[model samples]
Structure formats: structure tokens, C-alpha cells
Target: MPLGDSITGSPGCWRALLWQKLQKAGVNNTHFVGTLPAQGCGFTYDGANEGHGGYLATGIVSNNQLPGWLNQTHPDIVMMHLGTNDVWNNISPDKITTAFSTLIDQMRVSKSTMRILVAQIIPMAPSNCADCGNRVIALNKAIAAWAPTKNTTSSPITVVDCWTGFSATSDTIDGVHPNNSGNTKMANSWYQPLVDNIEALS
Candidate 1:
């Protein structure tokens, strides 16, 4: 499951790129599972994802949305890139990470040995949110620290860094959503970790 907000959906082309990469790498048995169908990505691929637009991590946890998705998909691995909307709403890093923990708990409940990949989200510079950049940095840092505590021998949580080399201004179409360049970068960031997880499953 490619789980996240608009950055992961709302025409998230990175999913397409990642899928293509997986195909090219001979990962034939894997399926990208989600409730939401793929948006227009200009090519054919497994576009199933749970990238809800304008959603918050806190909201997902409070409303208990993840369990249903997990029940529906029964995914062995989940690649999550959420919390950008939460940052935009001025939610603190601590709260966001807490929500993350709750979500992870939900995932474990669905499957004890779920291999999870959490993202250090890409940078954002939306005109409406001045503090979004700093908040993203803080949240990513918190995620880096928090993921280790959640790591287990059965269900491991690997944090993928999508922020290090990405540029908000140049990569995003509107300072929030990724442009083609950003999509490619995001896809590259997710590729290896995801491949490793798939290999482990095999």
C-alpha cells in the first residue's frame, strides 16, 4: 500500500515510476494495494494507493480509518508518506509522530509481521504555509528518532528519506505537490527499500 496524502496521490506520478522500476527489476508477483484507484500518471501501472488529499495523520488515527484499509487490502508491506497536511495545519511534530505510532499499531494489529516503510517527507514551500518547511524538517527528525523505537524483529519499520536532496521550489508544481522531477526523485527514494522488503517477503 502506497499510503499518504496528495503527495502520494492527487496525481502522484511517483507511484507509476516506482511500479515501472519494480517491473523492470523483475518483481513480478507484487501488487500495489489500496482503495483509491490511480490518478492520471500518463502511463499504465498498478496505481492502487491510499493517498488521500487534504487528510491529517491525527484525523486518520482518531477516526480509525487505517484498519478498514488494512482489512480490505491485507497488504504484507506498506509504504507510508503521510503527515504533510498535518504540518500544513500547524500540527506539532510530537502529535504527528504519535499519530504515526497509532497508525503503526493499527497496521500490526492487521498483520503482526507487516513490513513498513515510513518516509521522511519531502520538503514543502506552499505559499499559504510559511512555517511548513521548518515543520517538515522537525517532523522528519522526529520520525527518524521515533521509528527505531517501533522497530521489531517481526515487523520492521524502515524510514525512507525523501527530503534530503529534494527541492520544494523546483520539484513541486505548486510548492507542495511534486512535479515530474520531484516524482522521479521520490520514486528513486522508495525503490530500493521497497525492493528489499519485497525480497525479504519472497
Candidate 2:
């Protein structure tokens, strides 16, 4: 399941690119699961994802949305790149991570041994939010610190660094969403970790 905001959906071509990479690598056994269908990547791939546009991680937890999505999809592995909207809203890092912990716990309830990949979200520099860049840094740092403590042999949480080697100015089309280069970079960032998890399950 690709879980996040518009970065994971709303024409999230990174998912398409990642699916292509997985196919090329012979990872045919895997499937992208989510309540939402693919939103136009210009080609066919597993477009089902939980990438709700204009959604906040905190709001998702507050409204108890993830569990229903989890119940419906029942994915064995989850690739989450949330918290971008949270940062954009000026929500504190600690609160956002707490929401993350709740979401992880919910995932475990659905499947005790769920393999989870969480991203240290890419940078943001939206025109309206000048402080978003620094906020993203803080949120990513919090996520990096929080993930290891939650990692377990039963349900490991690996933090994929989507921040480094990614440029908010160059990679994003609007400083909040990825352009073509950004999509490629995001897909590449997720490729190896996803492949390793898939191999582990196989």
C-alpha cells in the first residue's frame, strides 16, 4: 500500500515508475493495494494507493480513517510517505510522529507482521509557506529517530531517506509535489528497500 498525501497520489507518477521498476526486476508477485484507484500516470500499473490529496497525517488519525482502509486492502507491506501536509499546516513534529505511531499500530492490528517502509519525506518550499522547508527538515529528523524504536522482527519499520539527493526547487513541480525528475528520484529511493522487503517475504 502506498500511503500518503498527494505525493503518493494525485497523479503520483512515482508509483507508476516504481511499479515499472518492480516489473522490470521480475517482482511480479507483488501488488499495490489501496482503497483508491490509480489517478492517471499516463500508463498502466498498480495505481491503487491511499494518496489522498490535501490530507494531513494528524487528520487521518483523528478521523480514524486508516483502519478501515487497512481492513479493506489488507496489504502485507506498506510504503508510507506522509507528514508533508502536516508540515505544511505547521503541525509540530512530535504530534505528527505520534500520529505515525498510531498508524503503525493500526497496521499491526491488521497484520502483525506487516513490512513497513516509511520515508523521511522530501523537502518542501511552497510559495505560501516559507518555513515549510525547515519544518520538513525537523519532521524528517523526528521520523528518523522514531522509526528504529518501533522496528521489530515481527514488523520492521525501515526509514527510507527520501530527503537527501532530492531538491525541492528542482524535483518538485510546485515545491510541494514532484515533477518528472522528482518522480524518478522518489521511485529510485523506494526501489531497493521495497525489493529487499519483497525478497524477505518470498
lDDT of each: 0.95, 0.95
True-structure lDDT of candidate 2: 0.95
Number of clashing residue pairs in every model?
0, 0
Candidate 2, 150: how far from true, in Å? 1.0
Q: Each model's TM-score, in the order given?
A: 0.99, 0.99
Per-residue error at 11 for model 1, in Å?
1.2
Question: Model 1: which ten-residue window has the lowest total lDDT?
Answer: 22-31
Clashing pairs in 1: none
